[model samples]
Target: MLWAGSKGGLEVRTSAGGATVLRGRFPYAVPTVLKDGRERLREVFEARAFAASVAAGGDIHLLVHHDFDRPLASRGAGSLEISDGDDALTFEATIAPEMRGVSYVADFLGTLSAGLVGGISPGFRVAEGGALVKRDSEGLLRVVRSAELIEISAVTKPAYPQAQIEARNWTPCTAAEDRTLVHALNRWRL
Candidate 1:
């Protein structure tokens, strides 16, 4: 399983016309802990691990909590743009007002604007021979060298603590509404 870092590197911008743009960085080279049964392991993505996958230009989606059914934007639709950076995968997604009309989507947007969404994470599958495990001073270390990037998501909890989000030009939810949305989002985990 793949684990994402903490929530601190996301930004959301809404246009006067109601188009919401979500931008964030999915960082590499940050170590996160993963568990396989009773064994604990340290995992980190090498810099540029996602370069080939992003360069391939495959269709990818911006989702909430990694839910396929809750996609907010898609690369194939020209609404999601991804770029491979030196140490992270950066993405910008333009969400139309029409798309936000979907019940869950609207809720997500509101929660995001209210600063309840945690951070962004990448959903990916490691390629063959793309990861190497070695013994380190801390214990077992898994270095991911390559992977197929499938999707990016806004999550309520993160394992890595380097991601962040910001909302601009958007109306924030009321305190009562924020509380309710937070309750709802906490229950909708993956």
Candidate 2:
């Protein structure tokens, strides 16, 4: 599974669960160990307080979050969506600015799915209202959020399972993603 959050800087955690740890982050850092009894893994970064801000504004996208000490400017456009029953949502996207890249569409859809599925799958699933959806399309995909939707980004693809988890030039969400998610979390009902 994948976990993305930030305590101060930028943090993205993806794990399959085991003693060995695989982690990466923005600002370029090393992976550390994090254990809480049943789960023993490495936590390379913490959730940044401004995480929501960056995400909603599309600060973290299409790049590895680690090894870079400089700031990155937003390069493209995107969209966000949410399922009516809270089943799914497309929280963010970063399609090519020229809008000629159809390949990137697949990656965006996959990332959206990865975000929500990753968020809910691992004990992190918040209440029905705790989720937000975002998507970015440079082509015909026109990203949408739904329980039935199972794709994201035309150019985006999952990293090697056994490779060290790193954030690279993948799609980045807009800061609005956070605001949208916060609202969804607050408004969710049984």
Candidate 3:
């Protein structure tokens, strides 16, 4: 998963049950974390067909680092859909009580609303092994590859600087990704 999100042009609002909502644009270009521990961007653009596939399932999820186990909530309880608008992929997510334990998500939204988080990252899946292309830092791909569709999530720290910016004041990192922890205490009162 690529790290992204920071301060600027982000609108966050708290709804019933303390659910935080926000809409933002993320890159369509997919990146892979190879088993050998190398990362590279893929050239195959996931514009509409990918969005259509996820929309068809209508079960997009709100997660951190593309970690399914760390899902804060599901799109079904709210709305998580992607639209390809002018080569830009925009998504809107509504996190509900189902994400009660994930307080950092609230904080992320709060910081984002305050223009603290300024980037969006793609949370996707790809086949274990396939004829994939190798892309350079400039996103120049050579060969063939494919990535499966999944949910796009909001992250406090982005792996790629171009992908998203990390807020200097926001220090909640590991705690933000602990999906297994049962957060009974509500930190965000927004």
User: Quick one: best TM-score, which candidate?
Assistant: 1
Q: Which one wins on lDDT?
A: 1
- lDDT for each residue of candidate 2 in 78-170, tens digit (9 for 90 to 100): 322212112112222223333324343334334544652122111011222322322223211111111111111111222212112222111
Q: What does the lDDT read for residue 168 in candidate 3?
A: 15
Backbone collision tally, model 2: 58
Order by TM-score, highest first: 1, 3, 2
Best of the two (1, 2) by TM-score? 1
lDDT of 2: 0.24
Give the distance in Å from residue 123's predicted Cα in candidate 2 to where it truly belongs.
Answer: 22
**Worst lDDT 10-window in candidate 2:** 142-151
TM-score of 1: 0.80
Q: Estimate the overall C-alpha local distance difference test score of candidate 1.
A: 0.71
Candidate 3 segments whose C-alpha is farther than 4 A from its true place: 1-10, 14-19, 28-46, 67-70, 97-102, 110-116, 127-146, 159-190
TM-score of each prediction: 0.80, 0.21, 0.52
